[model samples]
Target chain A: MSEEKHQHVVPYRVYVIILIALLILTFSSVGITSIELGEYTVAAALIFAVIKSFLVLTYFMHLKYDKLYIRVMVGFVFALFLVVIIITFLDYLFRT
Target chain B: MEHAHHVEHPDMYDEESSKIGMWLFIFTELLLFGGLFIVYSIYRYLNPEAFHLAGEELNRTIGTINTVILLISSMTIAMSTTALRKGHKKVAIALVVVSFVIGFAFLVNKYFEWGVKFSHGIWPGSEQMLAEMSQGEILFFGLYFVMTGLHALHIIIGMIIMLFTIRGLAIGKVTIKRPSMLDNCGLYWHLVDLIWIFLFPLFYLIH
Candidate 1:
């Protein structure tokens, strides 16, 4: 067999930890809905979701161990996504 | 980079390049769903009450179950890669199989959930939705079905890929040195879970 290139074996325990954290966040997001936060509810839920995605991307997808170029590529894509969302919101918020 | 340029072996594989290609594909997927999400946001902003009311009609318990199932499956698939790297071929295969089963379970749950909704005449373009629901509510359910349906399609595709990966593993084609195929499949599986992470909160947990 050829030598494994860029082989970075993450410990099994870390995956378990990330999984637990993700589950907890999922529950917390559900629990937060019971409270009467009004407009803040959606914001709070989305924040937790963002954090959960970050964990999945960094750990489960091995982006943390991946090269810098890949990281930059992902970051750019997300940034562009956010910009498009914000621009769309601007139209909705300002239209008479 | 160095190996690909120098080696002329027929079996030569560039795992790094393959991974980059997968990431690029994932980016396109993100943008594709990102467009849908924007449309959801606009409709929600326009008709907040209808969106919230429609969200209440969804079954939270089932949504939570499906969320947990997908998260666990994601872990199993990610760990399968580790198992493969450690040379535990059987364990790795077992983990991938577990992921596949759990993924199927998720779809089954979805089928029932959609069944309940359909029975209630809540489907898009249904006479009940058209006559009874507000414009915003109709739009909400429309996006709901379209987004989740697209996601289910992705899950099915991912499972098919996993099946092939298992076949490769069984034939000794996928080894520690040639693990890129499994790695790419794992990434795709995680992307499915990543999309669900947001979908759960957006569609089910809104109050």
Candidate 2:
């Protein structure tokens, strides 16, 4: 492996940008709670939550700089997790 | 001087390997908590009324503050790793200390919040006092206690790990040439923060 190729630097500006993004997300989540969006209120909250999670995972967590295999492993693990969630959901949704 | 040369072996796997190992550990952690989430979701779906009503009793402000604290800690820990990688040892040490102090603050807040709830008889099977609560409401508290309790355990473990990292920095066992110790510690700390990110909404936000 080329040492120079693997060595990378993250600028300070990136941290400030992510901080602003998280603050915006937090405010929006609190603001949306009051709107009577029916059942979709939770759905909307989750959507923003997922976006915020992505920002933290990608930038703050540095998963963005990881190798391809590591990324694949993370994706596979999450896919398996979704399967578990889905199976449980079906179990509750179908009710014996 | 002899020991210094021994620790500076360039052929050793770099910081990236340690970070990958930490991530793989977190992968297992996800599944461990995923099992609990599976149970929570199934019960919540079956008892929507109970879940929503129980959720309303939680302090939204406390949950929100904890969320911001965890998020900021994650950012600071990330910057800590960045500083170590750039060979800025003093900045790196300062950032790690900040993360540790913030983490302690989070646990202190959690202690008070949980203490108040316990005083109000919000424990499992405290049916005489939880009489106003429904059966599913009891289950909600059960799950809440288990999930957040486990997360708190992880935070304490992360703090212990950070302590060792700090000691390593002080003794010069860790340096930029091999910064994986801090990187791995940061990875573990970030996972603790990420878990709370999900927990905050699940317990505090209900529709």
Candidate 3:
């Protein structure tokens, strides 16, 4: 409670650059998914989405600038989410 | 720095704890949507063909436009947060208003898109859906409406939150020294966009 944390004010230029990158990723996902990639299509699209979400989480959500405890909490939450999905898929996959 | 403003509002403003609390709330929201995502995956796996076919009926162009719209809104809100922290109240409010307008545009697009589907009797429990669509297709549309409907609802709520944050900024309740309110609201706005990142590919681009 006595500690003074130096608040990181992210630069507007950085936000602009991130926005441009997000736009590129958005269009790239759209263009690539439009092609016939067979089974890999879903995989490709999801990869783009995961990257996009990562950017949003890290920059826009201020997770990157936040303290370690906050980052750890977010990481834990997402990791838990992934584990749930994996386990659920296991149950579905191994069903007799 | 915080001590300078400590006297202004004696109410203990624990920034880190406040942010932590918001994150905890976000985890719950994530799980709520996460449950629906599980349902979607199971059904999609069970009925891939039907899900794929039904996914085709959705307008990819409109979906892409909405995706861009949301991404823009997310950027503006994020920028607004930075602006507020940097002591540019007017710029901050302007960015949020931009976000609000774009968000409304997104809803308008969704309304028309849903209207088109409704006109074709494509809603849940519609006679055409039940009689014509396969079970998988029905499930696909059902999930579509449920997922997208819930998402649209979030967008509306986020916009409303933005309005309040704007008012807070207008009255000087939220400022450079006390940016927690706007920061939390920005977090929520980004969460809405984060969900759509997954929803777009799953619902619209899966053909």
Winning model by DockQ = 3
Off by over 4 Å in 1: A1-6, B1-9
Better of 1 and 3 by lDDT: 1
The better-scoring model by TM-score among 1 and 2 is 1
TM-score, chain A, per candidate?
A: 0.92, 0.89, 0.93
- Arrange candidates by DockQ, descending: 3, 1, 2
| Candidate 1: tens digits of C-alpha lDDT, residues B64-131 | 99999999999999999999999999999999999999999999999999999999998889999999
Clashing pairs in 1: none
lDDT per residue (tens digit) for residues A1-96 in model 3 = 545537888988878888888889989999998999988989999999999999999999998888788899899988998999999999999999
Candidate 3 residue-wise lDDT, B56-151, digit = tens: 999999999999999988989999988987789999999999999999999999999999999999999999999999999999999999999999
Model 3 vs. true fold: TM: 0.95
Report, for every candidate in turn, its global Cα lDDT versus the true structure. 0.93, 0.82, 0.91
Determine the backbone clash count of candidate 3: 0
TM-score of chain B of each: 0.95, 0.90, 0.94
Considering just the first chain, candidate 3 attains a TM-score of: 0.93
Cand. 3 Cα-lDDT: 0.91
Tell me the native contact fraction for each prediction: 0.86, 0.41, 0.90
